[model samples]
Target: MSSAAIFVNIFALSCLVISLIKDRAKTKQSLLVAVKSFFRILPIVLIIIIFIGLLLGFVPLDLISKTMGEQAGFGGVILIASVGAILHIPALIAFPLAASLLKGGASVAAVAAFITTLTMIGTVTLPLEIKELGKKMALLRNGVSFIFAIIIALIMGMML
Candidate 1:
């Protein structure tokens, strides 16, 4: 494991020990809730993992590169941002996907746009958002997010 992983583990363990010492009953209850939440999300998480694995395995690297590599330019960024906005994937699943895309020869800009839009925009939930936040607000939020995502991606591409 990396040093960062080791540090995080130690920190979590320390915090858990402190929680146990401060209040065993509450700590136990919290642990139960955490376990239940983990199991509740496990199925979807596994499905996403499997799907991404299959996609990466089946999709040729050359094709991925041709679509999202440095040579692909802003068009690639826009394409990935649109796809990200439309997909209803959890952000937890996106990090690994981004890494895979990078390894598959995707440009930094495209990957950045994908992550930003995946986290910021929600085309799948736009209807509900519109109902709750009003049509103008919902549209504005998504539109602004999409634009900024692209900008952020381009900046990251230049910097990285």
Candidate 2:
């Protein structure tokens, strides 16, 4: 595992210990909730992993590079960003997928845009967001997020 993963695990362990000491019942309840959430999301996680594996295994590297490479330019970034916004994969899986694409010759801008839109713009949850926050607010938030995602991707491409 990466150092960051190790550090996060250690930190979480420390927090659990402290929580247990302060309130055993609450800590136990929190642990149960965490486990339940994990199980609830496990199927989707597995599906995402399998899909990513299949994508990497079956898709030609040359095709991926040709579509998402430096030559693909801003159009490629927009295309990937749109895909990211449409797909409902969890952010935890999205990062590694983005990394794999980057390794396979995808442009930094495209990968960045994909990650940004995947995390920030939730097209899958739009109906619920509109129900909860009203249509205007939901549309504004998603629209501005999409714009900002593109801007951030462009900036990252320039820097990196």
Could you tell me every candidate's TM-score relative to the true structure?
0.87, 0.91
Per-residue alpha-carbon lDDT of model 2 for 1-160, expressed as tens digits? 9999999999999999999999999999999999998998899778877877887889988888889888899999999999999999888878878987987789999999999999999998999999999999999999999999999999999999
Residue lDDT tens for model 1, 1-160: 9998899999989999999999999999989998998998898888877977887899999899999999899899999999999898888888888988998899999999999999999888899999999999999999999999999999999999
C-alpha positional error of residue 52 in candidate 2 after TM-score superposition, expressed in Å: 2.6
Assess candidate 1 and give its TM-score to the true structure.
0.87
Stretches off by above 4 angstroms in model 1 are none
Candidate 2 residue 107 Cα shift, in angstroms, is 1.6
Q: Candidate 2: where are CA atoms >4 Å away?
A: none
Clash pairs, model 1 backbone: none
Error of 1 at 87 (Å): 0.2
Looking at model 1, residue 57 earns an lDDT score of 94
